[model samples]
Each structure stands twice: as structure tokens, then as C-alpha cells.
Target: MGNIYAGVDLGGTTVKLGLLTDEASLIRKWEIPTRKDDGGKQVIPDIAASIKKNMEEEGIRFSELAGAGLGVPGPIRQDGYLEVCVNIGPGMRDMNPVKDLSGLLGGIPVKGGNDANVAALGEMWQGGGKGYRDVVAVTLGTGVGGGVILDGHIVAGSKGMGGEIGHMVMDWDWKEAEVCNCGNRGCLEQIASATGIARHARIFMRESDRPSVLRDLQRVTARDVFDAAKAGDGLAEDVADYCMMYLARAMAYVSQVVDPEIFVIGGGVSRAGQYLLDLIKEHYDPLIKLTRGKAKLALARLGNDAGIYGAAKMVIDEREK
Candidate 1:
């Protein structure tokens, strides 16, 4: 009685798996180490093994499996191939992921998309973004990733590469380029990513001769900067403010295109909570098209599980559709 669906989030370090019931209730969840050296081959085998192991451990049968969805951290081609995933490895790029993974799963229908997009889908279907007609979700991890939903459906653009608000150029004159994996420069991602925040702190700490109350370390993290900002360190506050300014501009630009009613923020940096949200709202209003300032903001409730739920939604919807 194929009553269960599966969702897998393939990241650089780990693969998160979730077994969900027909009604979208999560049944079981676990993680597996990612084998980056084996390229895409290990991914499918690992995913298959995880699914089989979970079914056996939980006493479920293959006959009860419905479908599987995957959230892969890379630019997925319109036809469902992995075009590039710098976080993983080379050669896996431009590979037909959907075909390969489905084959590895014994022809089980497998659907795949960018990790961030699927994560947003997960939140919309089961987490904070639920019950909303239009929503945009951004996961503030090592780099910024985004997904857009319109009227209860995911919006994949003509190229199937939509919802890329992270690449929205906020400051054309800045000329500061970090070189994204996408081969672009001076992108908003370079400014608002977790790495950006930490880099900002490092730059500040270096230029000042005064000893920072923050423990002088070789490298400061985004969380450390947030803590310093909360503690009223002038340098940290300035850096955080810069991040807020860029984030606001990026959100405003996205709103102009997607016009989503709610913007749901997730990821490790988002844990900064109202402090971060408040700063974003402060600048978001001024940067937005005056006519489009009505969009609201919200925090993601699902945390890391969003990718799995989203992946499940992808497979289940395909099966039911």
C-alpha cells in the first residue's frame, strides 16, 4: 500500500533523510555522511541504502514506498540534471541527476531541484510559510539561497532557475567581488552571506588598534559578530549594519519580481532573531519600490528539516499529480 513518501537533502557534509506518511506527517528521520570523493555515484547508493535501512528498521516494506524527492546543493538543470555543485565535487557537474538517481533507486521515480528552492517549498508546505498564498524563503547559510512561491505553487522561471534572489545585485558601484560559484562578481550573496558577515568583522578587527572585547582570534564567525553587535561593540555593529543594508536591498529587489506577501528567513545566521529582522526591516522599506512595501516578514519555524519536507513535497506531488 505505497503510503509513504521520502525526502533527501544532499549537502556537502551530510545527507538528511526523512520518511513521511501520505498525509505529510514525518515518520522517521536520520542523516548519513556524504561521500564527496565518489562523485554522484555514492549519493544514489547512499540514498538507496538509507531508504532500505529505514524501512527495515521501522518494519516497513518496499510495497509501502510511494516516491522520493531530493534537495541537491547545486544548480539543477531545467531537465533535472546537476549542472554544478561546488560544495560537493567536480565532474558531477552537468550530470543527469534525476535519471541517474531514479536508476539507482531501482527505477523509483526521483525528483530533484536546488536545495534552497526545495527548502522553501518544504517550509511553505509544512512549516512557517504554510497557509500563505505567496512567500519567499531565504536560507542564510555559508551563502544565501532563495526560493519563491506564488499562490501555493513553486515558481520555476522559463529556465527553471528562478527564485535566485541571492544574486540580485544590490550595489553596482561597490565593485567588491568574491566570485560566486556561478562565475559572477559583486553579487549580493558576497555581501550578505555568512562568510560576508565574518569577513566584515575580520576587516574591522584588523584596522583598529584598540583591543576588541571580542576574543582576538585568527578568524571570527558570523555568530561571534552577532554577539559582539548585541553587546554594543561599535565595530561589530557597523559590520552588522552593512549586512542589514545589503540584505534589505536584496529583499526589496526580489519583492519587485516575486511580489510575495511574506518573506521567511531561515538558516544558522537567522538564529539572530529579531535583532536581524529588525535591521532588515529598517532598511528594506527604503530600498523597496515605494508601491511594493506592503510585503510582510516572518521567521522560519522548521530549521534544517525544511529541505527534507520540501523534497517530500516534490515527490509526493509528482506522484499524486
Candidate 2:
């Protein structure tokens, strides 16, 4: 067997750890609860201990491993400093994850990046963006998160805010748009995210006399809207189209800047499948005059495993360097 590598996906509720070969094949995976008590100071130590326990159980030696990589839920600077991780706790703010994690793991090399970026790397390595060097990955979940991979490397930017495609303002007029969680008025997150899709459904139901199957449900989701549209509901189609148009517009703007070869859409909302992709493409094609219909769109294949795979890839790439 090749040298083993460790990947950690640190989340607010659980810490997912994976063991993979240098060739990126998954050997085993497990998870532990994230003990957030005492300001989350024990999180890193807990991870280190878990790695040690797993290594012993698997009869693996530290020297036989190729280091580790971490995917954190916040902005990570180029030097491995996490700006702020609200979900983990205030204690993790302004901390050097790579340094602290490596120290805990007996000086083994460690690398870290934003979770979304790491997920993108995973997709590029083994999922939807596989075989593509330059790619854009967007996860349209409760909120929109994205990562830009250029020349097979993550563009983490100076402040680690490089692929913040969600916060891009789509509507400047606050009067007609809802305020985003980021305190902005009409960010793409406000209309293109999963929650945003439901919000649009509510708004359309309130303003129009047209009835939708969505009105029958106590809670409407992005899935319901897409399903209703497939059933040929007029109001649902309108809501779906409106939500997708903003996302398409955002992609068009991103293309003008980075111009990636493909766009991989993931997250809970993306489960709408080919129908959603077609809707976005329908609106996206006309907006871009220069690179019309050049970028390919695909669904994410890795699902929850993407983060760990990306984290493992980070270690593999670092070892190569």
C-alpha cells in the first residue's frame, strides 16, 4: 500500500476524518462530535488525538503517512491563518490552523483552506470537475458558497475571500429586494440560494393571483418549486425561472472575470438536477457575448465526501511540492 494521508473536515457539530492512500482512494472514514465547550480550544487537540487513535488501530506509523490537510468553515489566509470561524468559536479567530495542527501532530506537515474551496478541489480531483484544470464550483445550499480553481490550484485570494460569489450584489435597489444575512440588499445569496428559492416563492404567492402547488405546503423548498415547475405549474415556473436567472447572471459576471472552463453546481438545491441546469443555461447563454456557451455545467458527484477528498488532495499536492 502507498503512504496514508489524513483529511479532516471540521464542522460545528461534528469533525469528519478520513484515511486515504496517496493515490486518493478512501481507506476508512469516521466522525466525532465537536466539543465546543471552553471556547473550542480542544477542537484541534481532539483532532490530533483522533488521528493518533486511528493510526494505532490501523497499524500505521507516522513516518509512513504523507501529512494531513484540514477544511475549516471560515476564511483562511494564504499563510494558514483563519480570520474568523464563527461556527467553531471566537477562540479560533486569527489562529494559524496549519501551525497549531502540525504542532499537535508531532510536527507533521499540515495544510488548511476554506471548506468550500477544499470541496472544489475534491470535485476537480475526482468528481464533477475531474479532468478540468480551471473550474468554478458553487454550492447552493442554505447560502451560496463557491471556490475558484485556476490551473488546478485554489485561488484563495489575499484575505481568503477569493471565491465569495454569493455576496456579489445582483440588485442594488433595496426597496424591492430582501436584505441578505450579510446585511446586504440583494446579494446573489438572497435570491439564488435554496432558502432564496423559497423566499421567492413566498413573494410571488403574495404578489400574484396565480395559484401554485407550493401554496398547499406549509413549507416550500427549492425542491418543491422545481417539482411544481416540472408538473407545469405556472407560478412555480415563474419562481424557479426568477431564482435561476439571478444565478445565471452571477455566473455570467464571474465568467467575465475568471473565465473557468466549467461550472460545477452542488449543494441541497442542486438536487433539482438537469432541469435546474437547463434553466440556468437558458438564461446564461444570452448574457455573455464573448464566451457564449463555452463553459460546461455539471452536478457534483462526491456529495458529503467532497470535503475530505479535497482535504486529502491538499496534502497530496503539498507532498508533491
Maximum-TM-score candidate: 2
- The residue-by-residue lDDT of candidate 2 on 213-244, one tens digit each, is 89999999988999999899999999999989
Question: Per-residue error at 116 for model 2, in Å?
Answer: 0.6
List candidate 2 segments past 4 Å from native. Answer: 176-178
Tens-digit lDDT track of model 1 for 258-291: 7788889888889889898887888887766568
TM-score of each: 0.91, 0.96
Error of 1 at 129 (Å): 1.0
Tell me the whole-model lDDT of each prediction, alpha carbons only: 0.81, 0.89
Q: What clash count does candidate 1 reach?
A: 0
**Clash count list over all predictions:** 0, 0
The deviation in Å at residue 317 for candidate 2 is 0.9
